[model samples]
Target: MALPNRLRRLLLGSDPRLARMLGYWAATCLLYFIGAALLILQVRAGAADHDSAVLLIGIGATGVAVFAVLVRASIVMGIAPSTLAAWQALFAIACNIGAYVVTGPLRGVYLIFLLVVLVFCTFSLRPRHTMLLCAYTLGILGATMVWLVATYPATYPAYVEGVHFASAACALISVTLLTGEMSKLRLRLKQQKEDLLAAMATIRKLATVDELTSLANRRHMNEVLVAQERRIDPAGQPTCLALIDLDFFKSVNDRYGHAAGDAVLRAFSAAARSELRAQDVLARWGGEEFLLLLPATTMTQAILVVERMAERVAAAPVAEISGGMRITFSAGLAQRHDREPFADTINRADKALYNAKSTGRNRISLG
Candidate 1:
């Protein structure tokens, strides 16, 4: 069943809170078994009567077994960790109260168990919930104190019982305040960490990406080129670099406006992107100029790819740029040589691009 599988996983999983809960359960069971044994020993030695011993041992054992079963069921049912902790704290308080009543002659020792449970709750429950549990605990202990004084007026005087209650209440309130502050500090630190991570991500994006066109900037493209060049081998597939310049880009800016020029650049980028493969890198090299890096591509293949892109750019009019204007670009592509620097290859491509511009525009020149 799903329940069994979940229970097994919770028990075997590496979640710190769940592991701590299991340890808490085991410690409580061990304490119950120890208490039960002590009560049996006391009965045998005649230090305690049979009825009292049976009452204490029977209630403790039954409570421990029931709580163990509930813990497993809670895990199987996928109860929230905080809810499970609250339930455990409540169960511990109930057992403490029950033990106090059953072992009335040994009530002093039982109150220690109540204090221990309060301490455990401080760490496990939220501040508000822990405060509420403390109030409930104080109320029950106050009632038990009243009952004890009534049952044995000679032993537990009113003044002595008042002092004991006051001391325990002070201890509970101190722990609650301290733990509450710690929890708040922890939450603040976690939020700060997340905010810092978000800021770092924004900074990284700005450093590597162009703000206008959402493409890799010149610096990032240079890094990519260097990395690709290092990967070159004599037997491996070749890499090609292409430099693209928008023909008469300044005329569009002068005739229409800078906004129209910006629009045309964006339109050209979008059109060219569609013609390129996913692995191809496109970067805005400078004003009105772009760089394209084609990995595992030959000179012929890179030229064909650029030719198709140029055809597309010419056929399509950039919408809303000077009331829909057709534009073109000139490109020069060069393949990387064995052990050659990327700067040399880029220089050759730039020279070829100058030749393309001098001869005419709207064409690609291979170097």
Candidate 2:
């Protein structure tokens, strides 16, 4: 238990992603350990100098410590994680090249580290940066080979160095070029994933929202009713409901145009929404009809809310219509008691709406 908690704290401080980066570095550190062991073996066989090996290994160990400080500083300075990762790859490349320069007769084996660095860069950096790093690696390794031959012909011959440089160039260049294409493919797939997620969000809005009134449509209203029903059962509270219909709505479309009727509908929705509390939900049931839902409310409170809706609609005129027309609505109010299903309350409200229409056009009927 102690070990798990400590590990959790180390890996999941403020950023778990940074922990992942540290884990990647830990994995690569195994290569450093393996290279150190090989260096010791080369020293014992007299193929490499002990002092030069110790100096290079010391530098590599110090570079790892510097990497930790730089990463910590990057967080304080608000550096991006990807950019930090690129810096790590570059630092490792430098350390690997330094080792190759000092390793003498065992330099051929150390060249594998450069190939590993190229692979790491392909994932951590951009394709362009990866290509540049690959080119840089090839150039530096080639230069190191030429310098060793010129300075120490007894230990390093030009003919042998020429063949080694040729082989390293072909292998490193081939791997980098192939990995660059893979990097491009990865970027394209990532963009397509973002596009697909955005499309899904738009589709969800279309499914539950009325485009004309910009209000919650019937499907969404039903879901809201079910959710409210669940809360009411446990809380022992009443939920108020109102089914509203605009009086003489078809006449507005006939007298003016359908466009003007749309404007009137939009205006009514806006006015009613402004009169509602934050917890209240008002959705378009169909053409010129809306359902207003109030969670944890009594009949008296719900009636006041509906009254305010009526007053606001009367004051706000539809600009698209001639004479800046105002509208009136007939509403049927119902209250759902604790443990009562929403379907029963909604059915009663629908019947009461029919009564409001029969009695007079613009009044609220209680059921």
lDDT of each: 0.79, 0.82
Off by over 4 Å in 1: 1-80, 95-126, 143-161, 232-235, 311-319
- What's the distance in Å from true for residue 183, model 2? 0.6
Over the stretch 1-367, how does candidate 1's per-residue lDDT look in tens digits? 9999798786645565666677788887876676666556656776556896687677667777776666666656788767877877787777667655555345456567666676666556777887898889899889988987898777767777787788778887777777777766766787999999999999999988888777789999988987876674667788899999999999989987888888888878878888999889999999989999998899989989899999887776765564546789999899988767889999999998998999998788888
lDDT of 2 by residue, 70-188 (tens): 66566667877668767777777777777666666777887787788778766667788888888887877888878888999888889888887888888888888888888888889
Model 2 worst lDDT window (10 residues) = 228-237
Question: TM-score of predicted model 2?
Answer: 0.91
